[model samples]
Target: MSATYGVPNLEHCIIIAVIHNDGTMHSIGVINLEEFDNAAAVEIFAGRSLDSEEFAIRVVAVADADHAAQGVFALDAITGAAERAGISLLNVIMTPKIAAGQHWTDLRTQEYGILPDPAMTAPAIAAIVDGFGPLPDAEEITRLFTEITPADTDHARTTQRDNPRFGRDTLHEVRKTIVEYLRTYDPDWADGGVIGADFAADERTRLLDNTAEGLAARIGVLVEVSGSARDALLGLAVIDIPTAARIYTHIANQLEGIHRAHMLAVAAVLYHVDGRPFHARDALYRCGLAVLGESGHLSETMPVIGRALLAAARANVETDTARRFLALGPIAARRFGIETPDYDLYPAE
Candidate 1:
């Protein structure tokens, strides 16, 4: 019998583990039961996945669970899944205190509670051994979206000075500056991120990854450039500038009384191009929109009409409502050629 062990959470995600012949537990991925029921979960373990030797999964973990409702215990859920999969559960466990303290129980004996080794009993250590970072707590995860770092504040000021507002007549000026820099930079300068913090900056250079394919996909290129140009118009607030001028621009962005540093201009354009509406809108809240060129306002989602609505919603940007759809952005719209169609940035309601 293949032995499988896992952790179950009544309140959150349920994890499962793999027990090798040596009796050491190697943690497998967490099977989030928040969206699926026991029967569905059993199907996952039975033959096609995890144990099936599949490839990468880039899906975002989502949930619509009701905490008030009754739910199955993790221990029961995983065992039920194992049985349905025609496998045996050597010893499945679901408990708390992932961070500190020790809790373990004897799998065979009814009389003794086993205090297993700290490194062994903790699922995190096993996962780490298998090359995964320990899962972050909810507060830590939430902090990624909300915290505006000093680098963020400084990026806005510096970006603004280097790239100022421009009407359509003057938009051509960016070709000499931003465009040129994008084209001639050393490939190493645009290298993929070797570390975590470089993700967004690394993302900035992705449009150039497949030049041969990109050349064939000319229209795709236009879409990319247009979107970036629009986002650049909105995101140019990043360049550093004097405070008095910065404050004036902040007011125009319709941030009410919000300060300039909060604009998160670099992040705003990144979000806009990447199609993270919640993040983009949040950047707007901090004043990303203040960077938009006056002439750029002609388009729809350039957010010409929604300015008031967005301003009104500024206070609620911190809510989950603003961050609910953190997903991929659309492609086919990132290029520059005279051949293009005129349409709404905000399509009709």
Candidate 2:
């Protein structure tokens, strides 16, 4: 019976039991079920069920009829032992069939509420993650600059050149001086150690990293100025020197704004990582003033100079030209072997 039931090496004391309809039970030496219902349960229990109701009733009747059978009492004891062992005969019979009828998604939902679709969530997560890095490319900067109307540029340039307090030559010289200075100091500027070539290269590789783009935008200002100057010199258009000055001033202001934004973005990243609000506002103000000073406009450039100085002062009180001189005191002393004045000496202000 054990061989037919696939219950190999059955323990002599591990009794099998069955319940019947006649309010009686029977102890069986082995299982001989007509059909298997639950594969998992069957695999767990091996084979152990009555073949049919008729067979169960006959077994119960036979046990009840024989006084010395001991099968009925043994059945009760065996059933009680199985219950105490946490084995469920009915569950073993039906679990596999029930599992086969369920869908994978249904089971997931039942186990864990609603599962999020990866397709819908991935792009949004990527976009949010990408925003923590630098800005877009130089092409975007150029595109935005090109959007400035030519008429507006002309008006600004005219205003700066014709101001009674400022002359065209002064503004022109400012442009020339800056260009020469950049050419002469290119190596020094490159060596300043603020930003390195390798850093720029790494930034360039990442589409969202825009340190190179910021540098490119600064360079683009020179390109625009040169192109405008060439057109003026060639008589391709009526060159309003004052209007040109205003345009140059506007470019300087725009560059300052870009520098400020870039600094703020960098500071934000640093703050996130280090939990320190490093005072970058002053650095930005100083850098912006330096860019404006290099714009090549004279002190008498009135409204334009006044406006730029005001902007600088608002960013940092110490960013005005006088304060700038003070900040450069060390360098001036090194170069001239004397203490430099806290302010510009030539202006006598």
TM-score to native of every candidate shown: 0.29, 0.16
State the lDDT of candidate 2 residue by residue for 1-349, as single tens digits.
1111222322212224454545454544443221212342234234545455422321111122232224333334434444544443321110111111221111112321232332234443443344322222336433423322112233334544465422223334434433433333244444464666665444323422221333223323322333232222111101222222223323333343333222222222222222111222322333344445555433332222233334554664323332332234334223323222232324545
Backbone clashes per model, in order? 24, 9
Top lDDT hit: 1
What is the alpha-carbon RMSD of candidate 1 to the true structure?
16.7
The TM-score, computed over Cα atoms with residue i paired to residue i, of candidate 2 is 0.16
lDDT of 2: 0.30
Candidate 1 residue-wise lDDT, 116-194, digit = tens: 4333445646554543323333353244334322112233334334554322222333222234334333354434433
Question: Which residue ranges in model 1 land beyond 4 Å of their true spot?
Answer: 1-11, 19-27, 31-36, 49-74, 106-349
